[model samples]
Every structure is written in structure tokens, then in C-alpha cells.
Target: MHHTRLFDSYICLDPSMWWDNQALLKETKRALETRRFHGTSLYLGIANTADEGMDVTRVLTDTTTATLHMRSALQLQRYFEHNQQNGLKYRGKYYQDDSHMSVPFIAEYEALRFLFGAERK
Candidate 1:
């Protein structure tokens, strides 16, 4: 799902959402920035690894280890949000109470909803 365009809809769950120093995130951003895709869709379900009470703005600027994973996720999410000029339809969700270990199940459920054109809420 991550590499192929065979399917129109795809789901991403952490820690696949990130790699050391956010290599995958950067690569994905570059692809989205450079290439134009049509009839393709992406869904990212990011686990909330941020420290308690830390919001996305704060996490992205935090240099501590605690926010590293989540900061990357938020960065990717922010990228997917603002950069839609490439015609890649996308959606992202931050599970505030879910950890990386437990996010997949619910994320898949939400992904199904997105793929089926249901309400985000």
C-alpha cells in the first residue's frame, strides 16, 4: 500500500509513519511536492506520542525525545493537509489517546470510513 498505486485508497499507521530522522516522511513529502497524482488517495492515522498536554504546534518545535515520533507524524500530517496541489486526495487523524502499539485497529476502521466517503467524525 505504501509503494504501489494499484489501489486508490491506502492507510498508514505508526511507526511506519516515521523512520530515523524522518527519512520516509521526507521522501513522501518530496514525492507529493514534485509529482502530480490523479485518482489516488492516502489516509494517515497518526498515534499521539506527544507528551501530555502538548499540542501539535508545540510538539513540532520541541527538541526533546518525547515529542520526536509525534512531531514527525504531525509534520507529515501538516504536509498532507496544506499541499494538495498534486491532486492526491488525503486524510489524517491524530489519536490523542492511542499509542503506536494500539493505533492500527481503530485506524483501519477510520480508514475504511474515509475510503467509503463517510463523515470524518
Candidate 2:
């Protein structure tokens, strides 16, 4: 999960090998190249679990410093999001149909709060 005070938004994603896929990685690279998206600065991250292969976690921070961090996170996020898949491809994958994955938003929020801060603007 990733959090940013600039946009006041948090995002969580499954850590699957999809991140390593060449196609998705390329698309993500293209997206980042645009530099600006809908007036909000974007950041991405990837978290690895023993079960899932790799997953992309994205955080959008509009501020300059946050944006820079987001860029690095984006690189990591793309690495996993495009490469992993369930079953034969990824192995021992976890799947969630809803926006919230196996990980809860509140839990992720708390983590972000710890990582970023508790205050909300």
C-alpha cells in the first residue's frame, strides 16, 4: 500500500508476477512518461509476499518530493504488476475480486499513517 498527503488518497494492489510482464511494464513506463496525469502527481510501489509472486502498489502524491518518491515506487510497482499471474505462471497466487485485496484498506491506512503520518489535510 502507498499513501500520499498531496492527494489524500491511498492505494493497495495484489503482489503478483504480472508486474514483470513486458507488456504491462511498457504501458506503465509510457504512463509515467506523460509526467502529469489529471493534475495529480503519481507514485507507485510493489510489495512482495511469500504467497504471491509480485504485486504493484501505487501511491499518487502531488507534491514535488512525494512525486519523486512516487516515481521510484512506480518503477517497483511496474516490475511486479506486469510479471506475475496465478496458477502455472505465478504459483501459489492469491486472488481478490473487489477493490480491496486480501489486505484491508483500514490496515493499509494504518500502515500508511505510520509510514507517512496520521494527520490528514
Candidate 3:
């Protein structure tokens, strides 16, 4: 079961949901331009699903964010090697044997290691 499918029945029907992207982008640019660092840091570990609508290229452009691209998992493509080679603070890990729903088991572990500088066992 894909993660989104599990929540398919609970999607929001509110009209305000669509108003935020444009506003948010404008605010984000202003913040960035003003050098107002958000005071918190985040590491993104996207599954890099082949059909994902979010543009990986754009997301990875932000140097402050580190991403872990899952290469062999369902929904994602093989992106780890190229991204890693480019010195983008991204790591590639394989979960070739797991389904999308099962990826969290291994990915969560890898994410912790990536964020905390732990050695992989």
C-alpha cells in the first residue's frame, strides 16, 4: 500500500488549500533575500519516485538542505550515484527489495545515520 493511498479518503475539500503556494513563494523569496535564515535546519529524504510531481532538481538546488535519494525503492528512480558524485550533500541508499510502504523501515534508519553522522553498520 502506497503511503498516499492510505490517506486517499481523508483529503481536504477546503477552498483555502489552493491559495498558499503563490503567497508562500513570495514570502520565501523575501525571507531568503533578507538573509533571514529560518532558524531551523532540515534534511530531506525523498523517495525520488519516478512519478513524483515535485521537481528534484529544484529542491536539490538549496544547499542548506541535504537529501537522501532512495535508488531502488518503488516509485523512485536511481538518482543516488549522480547526486552523490556532484558533492550535493545527498546520499543514495538502496532498498531494492522493499515496496514503497516497506521502505520506511530501512530508510528511517539510514536517515538517522545521515543526520547524526553515525557509521553505517
TM-score against truth, every candidate? 0.84, 0.32, 0.33
What lDDT does each candidate get?
A: 0.81, 0.35, 0.34
Better of 1 and 3 by TM-score: 1
lDDT of 1 by residue, 7-101 (tens): 87777886454556778888888887888767888889988777778887898889987788888888888888878998988988999889888
2 against 3, candidate with superior lDDT = 2
Clashes of 1: 0
Rate residue 91 of model 3 by lDDT. 44
Per-residue lDDT tens digits of candidate 3, residues 25-111? Answer: 344334333432222222333333323443545434433222222211211223222223222233445343443466566667765
Candidate 1: residue 115 Cα off by (Å): 0.7
lDDT of 2 by residue, 22-95 (tens): 34445645544442333222222233222232233323333334233333435545443453321111111122
Residue 83, model 2, lDDT: 39
Question: After aligning candidate 1 to the native by TM-score, how far in Å is the CA of 23 from where it should be?
Answer: 1.4
Candidates 1 and 2 compared by lDDT, better number: 1
